[model samples]
Target: MYINGAWEPAESGATFAVTNPATGEKLADVPDGGRAETVRAIDAAHAAFRGWAGLTAYQRSEFLYRAWTLMLERKEHLAQTMTREQGKPIRAARNEVQYGADFLLWYAEEAKRVYGETIPAPRGDQRFIVLRQPVGVVGAVTPWNYPVSMLTRKIAPALAAGCTIVLKPAEATPMCAIEMFKVLHDAGIPKGVVNLVTANDPAPIGEEFLSNRKIRKLTFTGSTEVGKMFARGAADQMKRVSLELGGHAPFLVFDDADPVHAAKGAAMVKMLNTGQACISPNRMFVQRSVVEPFLDELVSRVTRMRAGNGMEDGVAVGPLVDDGAIEKVDRQVKDAVAKGAKLLCGGHRLMDNGLDRGTFYAPTVLADVRPDMLIYREETFGPVAPVIAFDKEEEALEMANDTHYGLASYVYTQNLARGMRIFEGLDFGIVGINDINPTAAAAPFGGSKQSGLGREGGHEGIGEYLETKLGGFSV
Candidate 1:
């Protein structure tokens, strides 16, 4: 663990093994921290908050820029580490590293852009101004999927906004966080400005985050249940909270769209991270006139994907994070099939072709999927595509919006007017009109409804770590 700019073991000398999801090989033994360790880290962050936040935006930007450059220089190493621990294809891991590093650069420039405003005063000789100041110490928790990007998405903004932070990375992927902090430390971040705590069990650390008065904000990226728990805990303190949680995004393919193009986009995005993404489209709504063509194209692309260890060459799909992920996905597929969905292709676990050791599942495609099925309502964080047929635009729109989650929704239509209408109608934080990859470092990424609270990335990201102080003066 990295705490107070020092590498240390748990006070109890307890450690937990980090294994590769692809091979089940022990990667490393990380310190097992609990509530006590969390308090220590939080104290350090509180002590350093004033000094860190005292730095000018330009000075903070220099530290961020240096870290960004160092991250790029070690991009290959970071990618390999992520692939080993997180079970993503090496190619995808590399792309994620690139994507994650971009956040540092983006926020480095944004550090100077935390703008304030001057308000007109009603009375003579009275003036009012609003200043954006850093919120105090922050506590953050990140999930395993997209481990590197998720950490950078939170860390870059907090540091850029001049807030000290204590992070608890997901237990399944602590090595990635350790390596990332190495880069930040090498870039000359001050002591106690950033801290990382790894724990086998996360409950105690989370409790400390809520109970500790020094922690002014809590940022989390994980399951909806856990995010809600954090939200409830933070209510007592009224600590600033930002959550990026679960998503069951819907992909709408209208009849006017070319079936082949839409299918390719859907397959590509659905299979990303083996479909372990908050924004991964969980339901595919196709106009009835083009359902057959879309299914045919989607099936072909999905079946052609190769599943194996992430480090191996030519492997497209990698193992799921663990047995639990495999079971959840398998259960969803079986329920969908039992409920009358046609299994077009790749419906079972992939144990053949030298894949028996890892938790690998086939890239599945299902057609004639109904809302009664489990996959329709739940997120199958695996490479399973369920296609639902729709007749009219209104029906498709209604089905798409009929979900508690509102993270990301994709629409494909050649008609400009129809695309615009659907884009406006979709009740999601991000609406991709004829685009599958909607998230960017320059744009806001988050959700509404039960999906999550607050945004990550873009100009709004840094705002989460800042407070607005209105100054009123009479001269």
Candidate 2:
């Protein structure tokens, strides 16, 4: 663990094993830190907050820029580290590394652009001004999936906004966080300004983050269930909280669009990170007239995808995170098939051909899926795409917006008017009109309803770590 700008083990000497999901190999034994460790880290961050936040934005920007350059220089090494722990394809890992590094570069520039405002007062002698200041010590928890990007997304903005932070990365992928901190430390971030804690269990660490008074803000990227718990816990302290939670995104395919092209796009997005991402389209809604053709094309592509160890060449899909994820996905597929949904292709676990050592599931596609099935309601979180046929535009739109999750929704329509209408109608934080990849360092990435609170990217990201102070000055 990296805490107080130094590498240290848990005082209790307890450690937990980190294994490669692809090979089930023991990678390393990380410190199994708990509440005591968390408190120490929190205190360290609190002690360093004032000094870190007092630095000029330009001075802070230089540190971030240096970190950004180091990240690019070590991009390949970081990508390999991510794939080894997280079970994502090497190419995808590289892309994520590049994407994650961009946050540092972006926030570096944004540090200088944290603009304040002056408003006209009713009285001539009085002036009203609003200043954006750092929110003080922050506590963050990131998930296992997209390990590289999630940390950079949270840490970059906090530091750029002049806030000190204590982060507890997902136990499954702490190596990525460790490597990232090395870059930050080498870039000359001061002691106690940033801290890291790794643990086998999250409950104890989370308790400290929630209950600690010194932590003025909390940011988390994980499930809605845990996010809700954090929200309720933080209510007592009224600590500033930002959550990027679960998503069950829907992809709409209208009859006017080319079924083949739409199928290609859907396959790519659905299979990204083996469909582990929050923005992966959960339900694919196709206009009835083009439903058959789309399914045919989609099934063909899914079958053609090669699944193996992420480090190997020509491997597009890799192992699932663990056995639990495999079971959940398999259960969903079974329930959907039992509920009368037609399984087109690839519906079982890939345990043959030396794949039995790791948790691997075949990319699956189901058609004629009804809302009564489990796959229709819950997030599949795997490479299983359920196709629901719709006749009218209103029906498709209604089905798209039916979910409580409102993170990302996709619409494919050649008609400009119809695309615009669907874009407006879908109640999601991000709408991709004829686009599968809608996220970037410069764009706001978050959800609307149960998906999450506050944005993660763009200028709004830095705002999460800042508090607004309004002053009435009289001269």
lDDT of 2 by residue, 369-447 (tens): 9999999999888999999999999999999999999999999999999998998999999999999999999999999
Clashes of each: 0, 0
- TM-scores of the candidates are 0.99, 0.99
Error in Å for residue 223 of model 2: 0.5
Per-residue CA lDDT of model 1 for 1-475, tens digit only, reads: 8889999999999999999888888999999999888988998998999899999999999999999999999999999999999999999999999999999999999999999999999999999999999999999999999899999999999999999999999999999999999999999999999999999999999999999999999999999999999999999999999999999999999999999999999999999999999999999999999999999999999999989988999889999988898899989999989989899998888888768788999999998889888899997889999999999999999999999999999999999999999988999999999999988999999999998999999999999999999999999
* Cand. 1 TM to true fold: 0.99
Worst 10 residues of 2 by lDDT: 350-359
> Model 1 clash pairs?
none
For each candidate, the alpha-carbon lDDT, in order, equals 0.94, 0.94
